[model samples]
Target: MTIQNSHNTLPLDPAQPERQARDEGQGPMPPQAPTPTQPLAQPTPQAQVVPQPIAYQPQPAAAPSNGVALTAMILGIVGAVAGFWAVVPITGYFSAAFGFPLAVAAVICGHIGRARSKRVGGVGRIQALVGFLLGYVSIAVMVIASAAWTVFLFIGSL
Candidate 1:
């Protein structure tokens, strides 16, 4: 059997030389003239569409009822007033117990109030903070007085 070269590829057109000779004899074809088309007119400037002003409707303010800030303020005032009775050991003991819970309640109320105020875009954040702080201070004073009484009693027994 005769050996054939695997790398040798066949040309697509065997008459390539004849085609090239014919193309060389004939020069490139001239471009055709464009056809006469209807001319387009410039568009007229459109009238400026002025937007009418919308009537301003005022939104109603949020009601103070059912607000945590109001609740916190009320509770804090009550706690602070009750803290005065903390001068007496027994009263202080009772006040501490009640005051601590009230203070915690005030704090929670204040936090909720502040968040709600931010959401509704109100203006009572400072009042809420004050209420919470006062409530905590009242509770602390009551607790301190109660502890002192307890220590005094312990010393007296010894």
Candidate 2:
């Protein structure tokens, strides 16, 4: 018997799936070439569509409201207006005298509003200032009128 070389392996057959090499570490499988009988694919140029921008309309933003400043200003104005009767002589000093404390409360609220405005946004600084001014004017008017009335009574008694 003739000696055959063991290292000389027989060529692998395509019909045998198990006999094919495992393609160790070689990247991807190469694309198959088209046969003479099969026609190559052709890429056709079609239309290019351009995207249209959307029409988006947004509403305007509203200014934030400060409740403390508004309340202070309202109280100050009311006290200033109601203090008119308190400036009178006899009965004015009785019932309308309560406006003095309201004025004081307005001043306190105005100070609180100012502090809050500094700490957090949206509190009205102008409204707080106006409230403070109104409170001060109301208190001044009450003091001066009361003093004048007392002086008038003293003079009348003499």
TM-scores for candidates 1 onward, in order: 0.55, 0.55
Check candidate 2 and list the clashing pairs.
none
Q: Write the per-residue lDDT of candidate 2 for residues 69-158, one digit (tens) a residue.
A: 777898799878866666777855652587788788889888888877776584688888788778888888887777788888899999
Global Cα RMSD, each model:
15.2, 17.0
Model 1, 34-148: lDDT tens digits are 3246455668999999999999999998665436887888778788777756768666777767777777788778778777778656767766776788788887787778778
| TM-score: model 2 vs. ground truth | 0.55
Off by over 4 Å in 1: 1-66
Model 2 residue runs over 4 Å out of place are: 1-64
Shift of residue 76 alpha carbon in model 2, Å = 0.3
lDDT of all predictions, in order shown? 0.72, 0.73
- lDDT, residue 95, candidate 2: 26
